[model samples]
Target: MPIRTTETTVTLDHPFALTSFDSVLPAGVYRLEIDEEEISGLSFSAYRRISARLHTPAIGVLSSIREALPIDTRELEEVLKADRTPIILPAGE
Candidate 1:
């Protein structure tokens, strides 16, 4: 089976907690890794998510070690939607 791994980062402005973590995480940039497997028997190529992992302690932190935690992608998306900073555009045409 062919599996594809995707890596990305998420940023939160305020402290947030995740079900997979024991404590609240500080606001900063966090790395998210997702794995998806290609599905067969289809006319078009498609992939389904297999798993998602979040890197602990945020990026650029002075931690000796980092832990990859298994997380629910939907939950993470909700958290991000609630925690994301809104961008304001200048008044101009």
Candidate 2:
């Protein structure tokens, strides 16, 4: 399927999950890049692929603070997958 990119904002009142992502998104606004596609066959054909990245937290002393924020527990497979970067602070910040 061919994919096109579209920009949208996700606002969560509670933790939310994405098919490809393991993390539960916290309550907040998240900027996302959505991919859309269309297919044709005997019946209906439509599919989409989307990808979004969150910034990693700091190490050592600041680690615990980062943990409180909503995100996946595992490490990112590809560290430098994109040119753009996201910045997330501690829960209170």
Which model scores highest in lDDT?
Answer: 1
Q: Give the per-residue lDDT digits (tens) of candidate 1, residues 9-86.
A: 999899899899999999999999999999988999999999999998899999987999999999999999988757
In model 1, which regions exceed 4 Å deviation? 85-93
lDDT of each: 0.93, 0.43
Minimal lDDT window, size 10, model 1: 84-93
Q: What is the alpha-carbon lDDT for the whole of candidate 2?
A: 0.43
Which portions of model 2 miss their true places by more than 4 Å? Answer: 17-23, 38-93
Quick one: best TM-score, which candidate? 1
Write model 2 residue lDDT over 15-80, tens digit each, in one string. 445444455544455544445575546386676444434432322223343432222323222322
> What's the number of clashes in each of the models?
0, 0
Candidate 1 TM-score, true structure as reference: 0.87
Q: Which window of 10 residues has the lowest lDDT sum in candidate 2?
A: 75-84
Instruction: Tell me each candidate's TM-score.
Output: 0.87, 0.33
- Every model's Cα RMSD, please? 5.1, 13.4
